[model samples]
Target chain A: MQPTSANFIANARDAIADDNLQLAIARVGENFGAKRQQAVDKLPEFDALCGRAVEIKDDVLAHLDYYLEVYERAVTASGGHVHWCATVEEACETVLRLCRSVDAKTVTKGKSMIGEEMEINPYLERHGIEPIETDLGEYIIQLAGEPPSHIIAPAVHKTKEQVTDLFHEHHRKFGKTERLTEGEDLVAEARELLRGKYLAADVGITGANFLIAETGSSIIVTNEGNGDLTQMLPKMHIVLASLEKVVPTLEDAATLLRLLARSASGQEMSSYTTLSTGPRRADDPDGPGEYHVVLLDNGRSELLGGEFQDILRCIRCGACYNHCPVYTSVGGHAYGWVYGGPMGAVLTPALIGLAEARHLPSATPFCGRCEEVCPMQIPLPKMMRHWREQSFQRRLTPGRERLAVALWAWFARRPALYHLGARFAIGWLFRRARGRGHMRKVPFMRGWTLTRDLPAPEGGTFQQQWRRRKRA
Target chain B: MSNKTQGGRATILGWIRGSLDRGELSAEQRAAIDSRLANPRRNLIPARAQVDHAAQVELFLEYLGAANGTFTRVAAEADAPKALSEYLSSQNLPQRVAMAPDAWLQGLPWEKGAPLLERRAGPARPEDQVGVTGALAGIAETGTLMLVSGPDSPSTLTMLPETHVVVLRASQIIGAMEDGWDALRKREGQGKMPRTAIFITGPSRTGDIEMHMYLGAHGPRRLHVIFIDES
Candidate 1:
């Protein structure tokens, strides 16, 4: 999970060249985009729900300290322990200590972005605890020895045929010698394989969608019930969450829930939205015996009062990612982080520092589709602009680009000189290129013309055209 | 273990408190927050869920159907087991089914079994083919069945088995998710909830592989509801 965000340009090119990844992410472009539209259209109060969701998150953030203390007290009251971690190392070590306390050999996990951020799997392996990803997408990627590409659909970069190969290669360990072709058969094979892990594991780890402060519950939404099985069957349930996840009450959580599923995957509700308060009570028949939450700040507390605070309101719905043209084109892997798309563009620079992730913000076309679809009403484009400014202030922009921008700005400041330069340049280009009306090569735009020709300036500049049209 | 920061908790809370730049909330602010927590205001609810009781049941069935949840409405609660066994027979499933000890599921007529084999009210075991339970409430807006775990109602019985047959009374159906919360607050006291409250909308499914859905990813592949209509 080491970030290639700094090398985003090269990674994006590689992703564009990857046929399997392109084919896989195209399905997201069609599936999530259409599903979300249909779901939103069906709900008349969808906009109102989004507005309320934004309000609820803003409230939680303003009183984050108060709400988190309330959440901790409530979890303690419900017989669950809450552990706070300021750094990723602390979070990983805390989870390790909990696993070690249970003498855990085998561990099970659902799809958790925070776990990936902490690189929990490799850490667990180093400590001799085998971590098994129980969700089908996570399990597939785990078997393939790759980090999840998408937040919601982890294996969206792999095709059915590729999955068939991964299963054919991996299922031999579980004594299935045959290769599976269809998605259903592959899922069944993984289910049969992980069902055993779910029962055998001593600890289960999951991520929270919303942590209710009023009830000390960690809510997870999933179409597959892997999270339910991962948590309910294990001896200990450890929830990994960021500090921003806590909400004031179940009613607040309820208001956000109205917008969550519709925005994420367009379901009214995911198959199972399980809210785990504590472990199994003494009188309960079956559930994990212990419950613990590892709440990680990981630079988010700094974001609370800053200009980037709005990003914390994110529900991790992936709608912004789904609607992002750049993401759908290059896919999630090119972003080179656990999160991708527009949200990633704004967030990666903030978390990992602009020096390392400066390229992520510039990767956007400023289409603003991500902000339009975001349930939290995050101004994604504006945040990207902010990151761009920060990177510029740090002198992280390339020397050639900075000079080119300065040269353009010199002319741009004086409209008369700018127009004179533009008229002369157009006249010169028109004399040579009026025949074809296109330029196969252009200065300072090789990257743009690398794949196709730039349209030659056949007509007069805008002022001339406007004067001509107005006269007519 | 030694590397675990002893001050991690205090440092994080301090950072959060400091980021707001307010040392403490004023009495009025505290009272406002406390009151908001004590009495959560009902936000804008989807108009679809605000309907008559019969319409609520109809909406529940419709929404559940959209989620791929199968349903069979019986004439009365007494006829649930018979209808359930018939559905099981149709699916060519095993005759034996595990169930929660909810009074409603317990009241089903176990003696009137022809196709049905044996039923026990307990936690689901590894060999159980089907698990039956009674839902605490049914959400009409999204066709979600709410199940709260207790000594008599294990979360396992709903999640473990290959097939789940939930017995939902028509009267328990509520409109909107907020109404469902109201129902839970009424059933239990305010500020207290079951250890686990699951809202199940459909059988377990995963679209992880190229966005193609496959059911029973980790929980029940087949979810059959023996919904008893109110006479």
Candidate 2:
């Protein structure tokens, strides 16, 4: 997980030029976006629920410490274990220790984004434990040996043809040699291959969409029931989540569940929304024998009560990515992290630091669509703007950009000079492109002029035109 | 190793306290938090899930079908076993199935009713082609079946088999998830939760490959529900 956010401009340029990815992404680019609109249209109370969802998360954050302690106590009471880790390494080590205690050699994993954040697959591999991704999207990426491009849809950047080839290349050991072209056949092949792995693995790892403090239950919402299989058949189940995922009660979790699916895939509910409280009961004939939850802070705890505290309310719904014009154009790989799109932009800087992720804040055009579509009503744009301010203050931005901003501010303070400069520049540009009516190239702003033509300015500013009309 | 992890936890809590600038809460705030934890409030619910009983059942059937599931209504509890056997025969699936050991299901004559079917009350084996279980409650708002894990009800019966059959009583259907939980509390008592409470809407499905959904990925390929009337 070496960050390439510092090279976001280059990565985005490359992503734009990747026609194969563009072709694949374009097929389903507006798929989630349009479906979300339809689902929202059907639910009259979506906005009201969003408002309440925000209120609920705010209530949790206001007393996060108390909720975490209560959640821990509940987990302990239910014969489950809870571990708090401040860093990614500690979380990984804790998982490895638990795995080693069970003499685990192979581990089956559900789609846990926190596992991606800690880069657990690689860590586990280095320690001689083979990690198998059971989620179809995650499995495809694991075969390709690439990080997930999108949160919900990991192999969204790959076309079916590419997946056909990847499966053909890697699944030979499992005897799935035929290149599957259709989605059904491909999913079936992966299912058949992973079925044995699910029952054979010594441990299962999953991510929690929400952790209820009232009952010490970790809930995972999935269209595919791989998460259920992963957690059920294994002898031990480990859940990786951040501290912010804790809620006060199951009812609170249910309230948010109504919003999660509609916002995520436009479904009334995901095919499976399973809540695992602890290990199997003594009388129970099935389920994991042991249950463990590893809670990682990793800098999220520092955002409490801060200007960016609102970002903690995010429910990992990729609505913002679906609605983002930039994200749709470049796809998720350009973000160069586990999280992509608007939420990624706001969160990447906070987790990694502003020095490396400074450009992420500038990745947006301050469109309010993300906020409008967010289930928790997170103020994404305002938080991105905060990051922008911090970037400049910390001198994380380039020197020339800082100087240009400073020069603009100086002129902006003097309205008369600003207007005069505007008029002169407009006149100069207009004269230079009298017949062309557009400037294909401009001095000191080649970045804007390189691909797009700037419209030639008119004869006068709006203020001068208004004055002349008044006089007439 | 435990000491290191514990130290990390303390340091993290310290950072959280410093950032919030109110590490110590006043008496009133602590009381409020404790009260909220004790009785979590139910927030705004979508009006779509709210309706009269008959309408709620209709909505449940509609939404479940929308999730690519099928349902059948039987006249009474005695007819449920026969209907399930007919379903297995029609689908050409193996007659051997795993059933949950709930008292209600144990009372039913699954083997006698479906003479061709070989059934046992226990957790599902990988070889079992079908798993039949009873739902504790049905949420009409989303067509979700709530299955609580217990001695009588094993969690794997609903999850392990390729095909799942859920037998529900019409009277157990609730309008919303909150109401469903309320009923669960009234039945199971406060803070006495099962190991797991699974809300299954449809057969296991995934759109991971090119965002095109394919049912029966790692869980049930087909989810069939049979609701029995109050005979």
Candidate 3:
């Protein structure tokens, strides 16, 4: 069951109503954005690095078919099995099939948007395989059975007390004796519970942050070692990745890696950056016996030849979301689906048709903060406008919105009538309000003035004031 | 971004991918791959960076301090156990410390009375205070330590403990990211890499709750790096 934009908006409003979430979000953006600026200031060639990173992605995408083949060959050469999935269903089926082949009863997963995008947990559940999310935030959300609201912080919508209650409720079945009191206590409790799951799980699944074509290595950056454990310890390891994650070489990936952590969390680097190439060797005492790489194309192949190609370069750093005014106001869940924030606004409509996601593009305030802070320098506002144009062309926009825009456009093109009509309406409306200096009700703007009063017009219209100034 | 195109005109991307499919590499991709391939010809692909005793000690202190890890430079491998014991005693850690099965660790001199449990098979309990192991390599760029699983440092010692104490030798330091990958390749041989090569930069942290970072979210809360200058 996919959540619609309306449902997400309701959830986000509730999340914003929480005092803790607001305070935490306020502290995060200011500190993280400042630290990232400091890091970039030290590196004189940061912009050049971004350009190079963009270039590498662009080139790889142009030759994606060849590069994917090269990556597959390299992985196979390194004794890792590579599975190609043309769609999300195929990708999910491939992972489930692998799990079944291994007779996997328990599966532990790292935080992967790809996993979220494919709805992997429910698929695994249907097969009677319990997929345990190892990342703390992911684990919390999995227990709550909710889709992640934010990209970086999946359970950002949750408060500490909520997490505590969740843990208490979930841990009751496990016969947990000690009740956690603080945030730290809760973390320790989760760790103790997940440790056994890590060791016992037959298969581990994670999403690749980036896949190196030259080395057949899949890069996963995590501040927690959950990703590491998810890739190791288990006998079988699977890395789910999109086609756009491929890079030409390790050096190119290095440039992007430098930016990823600083932009995401203001860290010099994530606590754990694991690069796994293949399965364990004979000399290795403990590691996964079988390694699998699932490359999901989904809609990316079509996106390659479209206007949304630039979105493929996103590193999922969540910087845009952190700095975005709309995102800060309404939060991530408001946009709905796997991805939220500005990226989701442009991407959701692209992946799923504009009609199903018409309201998502309209969710933004067009403050342009997302584009300004975007490390990839994606023209997000322009893309949103593009979607708006598409919606208008398809008549997916509401009748009222269409009428309003049409009226504005008609008056805008005819200057004489527009000015006369604007002046008369302003004066007439003011007189009708009986010197109240504001209006509590307007025709189409009833929704707008319902909560607050609209300030009366100052003096007269701009055209009238300009004419009087010219005469004087 | 346009919905429609001319009768026969292909889009910018169509032209690019179509040409690439015909083996006509773009000027950019060709340039990048060529430059990378040509790098070895210019400079004999230098050996991995090495750190000596003093340098390793300096790096250990700097990295540990920067990354919120505690470090003590010991004069000899014999003094390692004493420093570790002192750290644990001060922190009120349990009497028993889990030691990895390594030859270098076995050579350490400890208090004659204290009991140190050598690592065995199976899951480690929550009561476990510390796990000691040697790092496979250290990355200078990110101040990270690469831990490879083997007989020397069993994998469980890394994840199971409340505190992790890593004994690092200075000489194994590598300068570049590629140097680390090269070393891993050489160690694993062709077509074989470990299922996991964890490059731990600092303690575990997450900003999941409205982006308030809390360290020790899932892994070891405390990391102690013991720099050994055997040189």
Q: Give the whole-model CA lDDT for all candidates, comma-separated.
A: 0.88, 0.88, 0.74
Clashing pairs in 3: none
Mind sharing the TM-score for model 2?
0.97
Best by DockQ: 1
Task: Report the lDDT tens digits of candidate 2 across residue range B133-204.
Answer: 998888899888988888888888888888999998889888888887787777767654678888999899
For residues A254-341, write the lDDT of model 3, one tens digit per residue: 6688778877877767887777878876766666889898877666667765778788889998888878776776666667778777
- Model 1 per-residue lDDT at B155: 91
Interface RMSD for all numbered candidates: 1.3, 1.3, 6.9
Q: Candidate 1's residue-wise lDDT over B1-231, tens digit each?
A: 323444776688788878877676777987888888888778887888899999999999998998999999888877877888788889999788888988756866777743445888899998899999988889998899999999889999998899999988888899877777787888778877888999999899989987988888889999888888863
- Model 1, position A328, has a per-residue lDDT of 94
Runs with alpha carbons beyond 4 Å of true place in candidate 1: A470-472, B1-6, B113-116
Off by over 4 Å in 2: A466-472
